[model samples]
Target: MESYGDLLNNNKVIFDDRNYGFWKSRMKSIIGGIDRLAWKTVLEKWEEPTIKDEKAIHCSVGRKQFELIQGCETAKEAWDILQIQYEGTSKVQSSRKDMLASRFENLRMEEHESISDFSSKISTLAQEAVTLGENI
Candidate 1:
């Protein structure tokens, strides 16, 4: 998620006046923590539903996650909080990818789950691998 976010950010795909809605909505759709950002914009001040939804997302997180993301004003802030907390910096993310590569290579289908489920699991891992700069 962090890698993908960085990829998009590096491409200048978000953060523009024209792209604010597009980037945020894209983030909400594609990124995990970013999804906590509200989709609907209300005319009313602060938008009750938005605040409620953000609070719910925050409250559901663990203490560590909460501490990292505490006092976020928007979903983008929360998303950035988690990314920093988990990945620290881009250099750290590279190291993390190196560490995970071997394990990812060893990924296999478990017998207990159905093939579809197992495929889903591997496909998710594969996507993560791709995110981490691996070819497989």
Candidate 2:
């Protein structure tokens, strides 16, 4: 089995702006796996980690992503910044959810589309909705 240090080094979760939901889940898993306190550092505004959770976050992201969280003092602050940047505010999220719901309601398989292709489209839409914190 890989050591914890090995896991930390090998399983860094890099965030690309396009898939914030997937990246957020992966990063949470990685940090939580490292130590509960480290994950708590991201969730709790005031909790500090013995290990620098911010460093882990910094090392996992690229230069552009780094700029988003560089000014953060706490790990939770950094996490929130990225979350807001990618997920937008709650109002924006609600609007996005409405748009996605409309798309899902109107989705129809094209005449030339295969069943598999149509199913894939549905799956993608469903996944995106789930990423946005929708129950669908």
Candidate 3:
């Protein structure tokens, strides 16, 4: 839910080219929970950098990704298009899974770190995995 969380904090979502899961989950929570009439307004709030009304998406997306959503009438449509474009195929998903698994395997709590810091580190990684479709 990082994207939605960023939006809630009045910050633009920071997306790397690869982090589709994090963005998609947050989008689902927002879009799925709301009624159809509320879709455009909510999409406007998160994607537009300005508070003024306009028929556009002005968020922090890449140029190609931005092009895919041009003239989209609803945030839901834009989100769907983005999912199709960036979610990748099964092989890509497998590769990402393997990479994350290796990182988690090498993780260790540093001796000098406070208990809170250690817990937060663990929690953040765990949250990331969960967002990426890990059962844990």
Prediction 2 TM-score vs. true? 0.81
Q: In candidate 2, residue 41 scores what lDDT? A: 58
lDDT per residue as tens, model 1, 58-128: 54355656676678765556766655555458888788777677667787877688999978877766666
Quote the lDDT for 98 in model 3. 80
Q: How far is candidate 2 from the true structure (C-alpha RMSD, Å)?
A: 2.3
Error of 1 at 76 (Å): 2.1
TM-score of each: 0.44, 0.81, 0.54
The alpha-carbon deviation from the true structure for residue 73 of candidate 2, after best TM-score superposition, in angstroms, is: 2.7
* Candidate 2 residue spans exceeding 4 A from truth: 1-4, 50-53
- Candidate 3: residue pairs that collide: none
Model 2 residue 12 distance off true place after TM-score fit, in angstroms = 2.8
Where is the poorest 10-residue window by lDDT in model 3?
49-58
Clashing pairs in 2: none
Estimate every model's Cα lDDT from 0 to 1: 0.53, 0.79, 0.58
Worst 10 residues of 1 by lDDT: 37-46
The residue-by-residue lDDT of candidate 3 on 18-128, one tens digit each, is 766665555544444444544555545545435443222336455666777777755656665675566556676667678778878887889899889988877767766
